[model samples]
Target: MRTTIGYTAESIGYVVGAQGLVSFASQTFFGTEWGWLHNVVDLPSTAYLGIVAVGLALIVGGVKMRKTPQPQKAA
Candidate 1:
């Protein structure tokens, strides 16, 4: 469960980061002619902080998954 949640968080982080990049590219490179994604997928100051928090949680979850032992299967 923990590992699954960690992976999920990582996926979300990638999506968020990608959205930010797309927004930047659309507004800066593409002359603000972006798609709906930029409108819905945005990371402002506080949201960026949330992104950082998600990253930290991912790292912590990875470490915990590595340090913790796995359960054995029954015969």
Candidate 2:
């Protein structure tokens, strides 16, 4: 159960991080925000990096949880 949750978290983090990176890059490099979600949900320029940071934190937590060994169940 814990491992499943960890994998789910990691997958979500990857998606969120990718979205943030794309949005941040487009705004910073192209001088315009680009992303379907970004267009629908407008946000301050500063918040994009924050989103990325959160995603990174999630990824780390998920990976750590997944790596840790589960305790044996004694019958």
Candidate 3:
């Protein structure tokens, strides 16, 4: 159950991280010309941090999963 939760969290993080990069690109290149797109400039940094955070989350989740014991079948 814990492992499943971790995996879900990691997946969410990955998605957020990828979006951050895209947002950054749009903001950096388009700026105000893109209207609200200018807000995306901070995306690069946001994405970078998100990636790092997600990476750590994955590592921790993986370790937890490995440590978790599997259920045994009845004899």
Candidate 4:
């Protein structure tokens, strides 16, 4: 159960991290060109939320891993 939760959290982190990277790149490279899309919706807040989500997911995954017991290795 813990392992499953850990994996899910890690996956969410990866998704959020990817979103942040993409938003940063687009904003840096395109500048006002991307503003058109922003005008259609709240891009800035969305980007911020994505970053925060990534951080939270990472924290959850780390906590789960630290608290869960490791399986024994075969000799």
Residues 1-75, model 3: lDDT tens digits: 766776776676556555554455555566522223234443443454564466566656656775678788799
Candidate 3 residue-wise lDDT at 52 = 48
Worst 10 residues of 3 by lDDT: 32-41
What residue pairs are clashing in model 1?
A: none
**Candidate with maximal lDDT:** 2
**Ten-residue region with minimum lDDT total, candidate 1:** 43-52
* Model 2, global lDDT: 0.85
TM-score of every model?
0.51, 0.86, 0.45, 0.53
Give one digit per residue, the lDDT tens place, for model 1 in 15-75.
Answer: 6555555555666565663444545655443454454455566656666665577787899
C-alpha positional error of residue 11 in candidate 2 after TM-score superposition, expressed in Å = 0.6
- After TM-score superposition, the amount by which residue 61's alpha carbon in candidate 4 deviates from its true location, in angstroms, is 2.5
Question: What is the C-alpha lDDT profile of model 2 across 1-75, one tens digit per residue?
Answer: 889989989998988888888888888788887776496667766678888988898899999999999999999
Q: What is the C-alpha lDDT of each candidate?
A: 0.57, 0.85, 0.55, 0.62
Name the candidate that leads on TM-score. 2
Candidate with the larger TM-score of 1 and 4: 4
Clash count, one per candidate: 0, 0, 0, 0
* Model 2 residue 20 CA deviation in Å: 0.7
